[model samples]
Target: MAGGHIEGWSPESLEYLDACPVCGARTGQELLYHGLRDKFQVNTPGAWDFYRCGACGSGYYNPRPTPESVGRLYEAYYTHAHTAPLEYAQLSLLGKLRRILGNGYRNYRFGMHERPASILGILAVWLMPDQRALLDTGGRHLPKQPKGRLLDVGCGNGDFLLFAQRAGWEAIGVEPDPKAVEVARARGLTVHLGTLETLHEAPESFQGITMNHVIEHVHHPRATLEHCYRLLKRGGWLWIETPNLDAQGHARYGENWIGLDTPRHLVVFTDRSLLRLLEEVGFARIERLPYCPLCERVYGMSRALAIGASPHQSPPLPREERVLARQAEANARRRPEIREFIMVRAWKG
Candidate 1:
């Protein structure tokens, strides 16, 4: 899907990649997914050629920008032009409707449409159930009564922090976006403005730490994790949520998939790669759960739309469309597990 016209000249700001995130042997380059030039990526054709690393199962955009130059890709074009609203609006709607519909309906139902979740929030649930369950879970298997502090990396508008606060946890958000931090702060959320790398304040400080979908955007994941390790209390949890190439949508969309919003996504993850990462950085009790249904539906529909196959593409409806629609509806009714998340809990041991 990444094979577009590739127009924009993303200045060649390449830098040496530190040792392989995995293997650490410096020889980790294998192309696992080759993309076909689709209408989705019909841009410069000269910009970025994307590929996957076979050694570690990570997807990346080649001719990649240096960490600093990455800001070049975050312009309005990248923000508004690249984002799809229907999906997120749908999620926000579901979240508001949680009352009439109820939340725990899933703990009992097998495959009903999942109550909508911010991908980041859902990933938070999967990675730190003990944290998320404080609200959703009726206290079974919950971590000892919540206490201490929590840092929401890339905390966005502080929705998750507010949720945490409701659950009796001391929560604060660390967001680099001033506008976002302002919004969260308006909601009375405690937000710090700065990157975690520059924050020289703690060692084993937090009870839990989370970086939701923001790790891929950072310039230094290794350096970032080093801080996460320092900020967490012993036997604490580090929840970092990045896209999982192992999901079915990546297979369906190939490159043009918005999930792989190249240059922007920067570093995509797979189960093995994340586990390897956690261990290398001294995290333990790592768990990987890929809730495929949610990612598949959101990313799949976006990919479909990109390729003129979605209902939004103005393409005429087909007989198969009816069947596919029925299947989607039925599947939604079945409440198939949709999210794919990696939960890594580290004990001071």
Candidate 2:
């Protein structure tokens, strides 16, 4: 097999898998993409190949960076930066109204106590399904578990940890990156400085566990999920969100899809394959959450990539692309498998 070498890392440093990571099938593998570069970050130097498993419809990089070397790819990751909360005084009138209403709905639904909230906000948000969906996602779809313990794997600067803390959960995080862990700890969060594999939390300790866009980056996704299963209480919930291999964005842009962030994303799963994995892992009451309003951002970035433009520095998205994004969003609502990302919540039964 042909491969690209990263600087300072020999070919032997890359781990080549002989079987499909998701299903363990080795006989029927098909090469879907070759010579794919890290277009989004542009920091990793390599032309990677992505293969699709005929048995499972999942995708993975064969010669992916080993556990020791993969940290180099995330040296400049977005999670290293600390995010400040929006100040109430700095918001425009409309922004303030939206914030107030959002807070109100959160307080009512998630048992939060955010200030400037009004009881009317619940009715207002209930009338807007799209906005409600976004709010639920922001809250990780976990209902308020008063004094419940929550663990965020790959917590990344602890943004969600802060949110969960505010929502009445004892939120703790596990992060691998030292920089990100430092930033998260500076926020006064109780974050364990390592991956889930290295986390020494007692089994069945957490009421809820969440992994947002973290599973694909792990060297062993199955092991990660199994660890999460053991960490949650028997009736606790586990939430996960990752890029869907069979998304409309992939169909539209193919290799240029922003979801395919090169060697960083070791495995990209389809909805069916992900569901199967969850079932095999002894999770029950699995529910697929609705895709949030993200088509514009995803499609815009993909369009920028396709046109050889930096997604961050590119001009405004074209009107036609916006139209296409709206159309895709509507299509995803009806046929959820086509959504750009897969979000699921399951119970450890």
Q: Best by TM-score, which number? A: 2
Q: Worst 10-residue stretch by lDDT in candidate 2? A: 1-10
How many clashing pairs does model 2 include? 0
Q: Candidate 2 has which clashing residue pairs, if any?
A: none
lDDT of 2 by residue, 9-38 (tens): 588678888889898998789999988888
Q: Could you tell me the TM-score of candidate 2?
A: 0.96
**How displaced is residue 90 in candidate 2, in Å?**
1.2
Regions of candidate 2 where Cα sits further than 4 Å from its true position: 1-8, 312-314
Question: Which regions in candidate 1 have their CA more than 4 angstroms from the true location?
Answer: 1-25, 31-46, 75-144, 289-292, 308-348
Tens digits of per-residue lDDT for model 1 on 229-248? Answer: 88888877776656666644
State the TM-score for model 1.
0.67
lDDT of 1 at 4: 30
What lDDT is obtained when candidate 2 is compared to the true structure? 0.88
